[model samples]
Target: MVTIQGIAFIPQNISKGGEKLYILNKQDVPIVDGLINLNSDSSQANLSEAQQQLDLLWNKLDLIEMNDELKAISPAMAQGKIDKRLIIVHRYIRLNYGEPLTLQLLADLINCNPVYLSNTYTKLFKITPMKYLQVTRMKKASELLKETNMSIKDITTHLGYVNNSQFSTIFKRYFSCTPVEYRRNQHLQMRSIGIF
Candidate 1:
């Protein structure tokens, strides 16, 4: 699973060396949620059901990304396919987004020059590494706001922001609403759907 610009994609490699990335929207989130729930059953029937759900997810996804997007996502075949370091950095971001991260820190992880890392990352990902990190944190913030009882003040520190005001500013910019407002709306929606 990969998320960019508030969208999640389930990327599957083709039979050969290439890959096809299926773009999933907010509406397809249930497919992922169901997949997680179905994963715990450990039965043949559940496995079949899980496979059907995956098929349904694939059916619901949009087509492969455009050439420009694919280019940003992957380097040319001549450049040794994809950079291993970038993959490491991306995976690191997904795992540790709650912590404070800087370009120098990310570059130090792979023993590369900071400027080179930033430039190459943007060329490959179409966004600066820090921007990627912010988006990642915002995504996690939304999940926490909706699913956890942690107060907004605590969530601010948990997400590595200096204070509530800063977190609120960024959250509002990202979601067009304060964190509390987003959480309330999410709860209302969930209640309406009989999930709460």
Candidate 2:
């Protein structure tokens, strides 16, 4: 299968100028190779159809780029390109905090060396990526504890902890209270506010 996804962004300047315009296109098509004999008439027909679709997509992209609304945004996008590697790492951590994560795994995700990723991430965020993962996991665990009826053991397991004791130790070190205490305190605070 082949999928083409497009997103359009209006620069800050354009927004300040009081114009809102965007064009987004998303489509998916199944592509099968070796489905018919190479010289067969059916194969030739399918190839022609695919080529027409691709040409249409390119025409649309060209039109969008030539549009005045997109012209105002293109230069800004070109001038202020964000670091894709950093975004990828941050998103991976946020989405996968419940899974076991390691420095090497994060580096692999961004196709960079572990040492380089660690150094770059530390410089950009003032904390190592692994530490960020740990903090993220702790934050999520804290939220789950306060909001759900899940037990300590379940929360620990959900956050990728090997055991409840280890989870409690780390949770205490990070939040200055064990998970149980934190949950109890949250409940008491909620009650005081007439929420519980």
lDDT per residue for candidate 2 within 1-196, as digits (tens), equals 1123443433222454243344332322122222222213346576566546545555554354345433444454577643458657966887888888888898898888999888877765556888878877886887788768999988988898889998999999988898988999999986675444
lDDT of 1 by residue, 97-126 (tens): 878888899999999999988888887787
- Residue 165 lDDT (model 1): 95
Off by over 4 Å in 2: 1-83
TM-score of each: 0.63, 0.57
